[model samples]
Target: MPTDDMTARPTTSREDGLAAEVRTLLRTGLPIRLAAGPRLLGLRGVQARARRPDDPSSLARALDGLLREQLDRLENTGLAEASRLLFGAEAATSGATLTARRQAAADASGYEVHHFRKRIEPKLIDLVAWQLRRDSDTFMARHATAPELRAATRPLVLPADVFAWEAVEHQHALARLWGAVYLLRAELLTTARLASMDAPATETDAAATRALWRHALVLAAAAEYRAAYGAALLDRAGDTDLGPDQIAAYAGWTPPLSPAADLILVRLADPDGSLADFTARLDAARGGSELTADWRRALSGRDRDTDPNTLPAAAPEGSTP
Candidate 1:
């Protein structure tokens, strides 16, 4: 999730600025303010994932995700509740102003508005700021470790026709992409199950649904990448000038779908259904990913004239291919 935009880890002074920016965004709770907020705007990785860098809604969602993650880590229920109320993280208070949110927090926590403002508000903002700092560190560490990790992994045995470097790059990208998809899929399943029990819609529920949308976006991008790669392969095989439909007919290399993909496709078509609704449809379909089975079949198959013994042996664990 980290981007290439950050060249160095943030300093304590930079974190203090982030905290101030977070406080301003929380106080305004305006999309425009959030979109322009220096701290949020500086999250180039998050912005790059959005449909557009300037999208206020996407920026707001990212902010919400950070807050929710921090909230989930809190051990104190009172602080969590007060923080949620103060941030208008619930549907009922989402449209409330800063003063209204403060009063709500005060009423819920049995504290005067002034006292809550002087005590709780600052702490909540600091938490978010701390999370930002932690995220920056994580980003830097990931980049730092990536080269060593790649060096440790076995090299992929790609088709001879494909460019080795390009294939390796694609393989690495797909590995990360599918990892995200599966992780999001698990989260969706858990959240869907919780929704099936008839729980009230909370900010957490909304966050999960938004996460599904993000999963869908990633899938869509993967689909596009696969199509392009397939087209290139076809061209290399002397099959040129194929139309979109023709290319799509060659489904052997297509990204395999699961229940999550089915639900996402339906939601993409309608765009109005909730997580619960999608869960019901998904249950009816009872779908699962075919990726593993597909890979096994591809790897196990051979031509009639080909000798099985001539093929390369499997790469040993931790050995280079």
Candidate 2:
């Protein structure tokens, strides 16, 4: 799991900051849904029969290891100190809600809003619970000397008194927290992925998971969507297409376990192969990306006019993508 920073640092394709970093990790890394246990176990069984065997755990395990690597980078980068100052007090509070304490911790640590929105958005009672389990006096002592800890709790400094690096340092902590939080989700999702990784999950479950994830991915990839993706996707999907349990699984990090589900999503996203005449014709003319754009824009919380440039020529104003 050890990585040489100078050598192993990713040659990132863009500098769009934390959002891009997280998205890249999500896309390039193992789906997290197939991280371990029976599913991975079955994969090993499949590989034994093939001439060109694949190491499934390279993704299932290594991606998780990568997440931890990112977390260590954060802690060593001074996020641990940031946590000590910003969240030390309230995190040690006897009766505070875990949610409030987590927000305080994340805020104090300097996590950016965008980073929080994308990577650290999941449930995080574990971090707060870890903090709360500390002895009260020990908790207070660790943060007692950190001036920013007090400064964040109070409004002592003028705007001009603060330097940009201090803000940057705080923001740096957020990136660390985001990766760490994802590891937690990875653990949970992998469990579910491992569970449903078998034949136990119904065919309907796979169908629903694939539909929802594809819709969500399209919206997440597109920039023009102004409304909530959830409301839009659900509005279009029926109870049969996206079950409540499937929704929870997807949200929690469970990947669609079905090979059929995986293939369905990939084919839809890529828009190739045996298709209806109009659909194939549309792909041929406007390009597969444009059709995806139409679908993504169509599935929004509120109905809005689609950008003409982004959609295929035949994609009518209000029609589903």
Candidate 3:
């Protein structure tokens, strides 16, 4: 007697159907764990190879590695490196540099610098989030884990080591978000720590000037609007002291945030000139450039941006749109 048997290869329709279903699930932002081997394999293949749908796993892994590297850099690298291109680390932080402080803290706490949750701000959080969004697939994979998602929204104070082991998703969006927050907070804390040292900044040279400007850009990207302004004030003068041209450059480097911008202007205001005249000179020095009016509201103590009623009582003399 012959056994009844059917052997047939999987059809094209079956493969196409599977691909379509996988795409739909990915669009919904579900976890890969919910997927079958075929789907996961396809997704991974697409992502790992940089094909369409851009593998979530690949993106996740990339972000994970980047975060890890950043933490390591923060730990192993000295403040001199971290501070080199940004604010004049030595001057801004007094004689002590970022490397020194991290080392000091590490020594005192008996924990690796990477183990502590560094103080950071929301702006950095935004930056990290923006970066994570660039790798959509990785973000989706990390999103699959509920605990990881929650952890991201509310970051932990512990260092990278504790979380590294739990590696739920590489380039975890939640992790990246939290890491950004940590970085921003740490920078602010570091700045404050430096300020509390209470030593007048040493005479900053041209090298320091360039560093401070670079720092200003980093702060701007992190949305440390105030810090960006503060860095400008701290480095406003050269080794020779505040000159006419240098002062103008400081004003132009002001962050786009109105409140922050006003603070810089206030800090850099010439003793002999009125605010109006000061701003005019600033404009002249910068070839008639104007600070956007919207930022003016930040100076006036309004929490929100400038609106119709919030317009300056009158534009400063010599002001142009």
Residue pairs whose backbone atoms clash in candidate 2 = 110-170, 111-174
Candidate achieving higher lDDT, 1 or 3: 1
The 10 consecutive residues of candidate 3 with the worst lDDT sum are 1-10
Candidate 2 lDDT score relative to the true structure: 0.33
TM-score of 2: 0.18
Q: TM-scores of the models, in the given order?
A: 0.40, 0.18, 0.19
Q: For model 1, where is the 10-residue window of minimal lDDT?
A: 312-321
Candidate 3 local lDDT, residue 206: 20
Write down the lDDT of every candidate, Cα atoms only.
Answer: 0.49, 0.33, 0.32
Error of 2 at 180 (Å): 49
What TM-score does prediction 1 earn? 0.40
Tens digits of lDDT, candidate 3, 117-200: 242211122222222233323523311121233336665554568556434332343333234344434444443344345333
**Candidate 3's TM-score:** 0.19
CA deviation > 4 Å runs, candidate 3: 1-45, 51-216, 219-289, 299-321
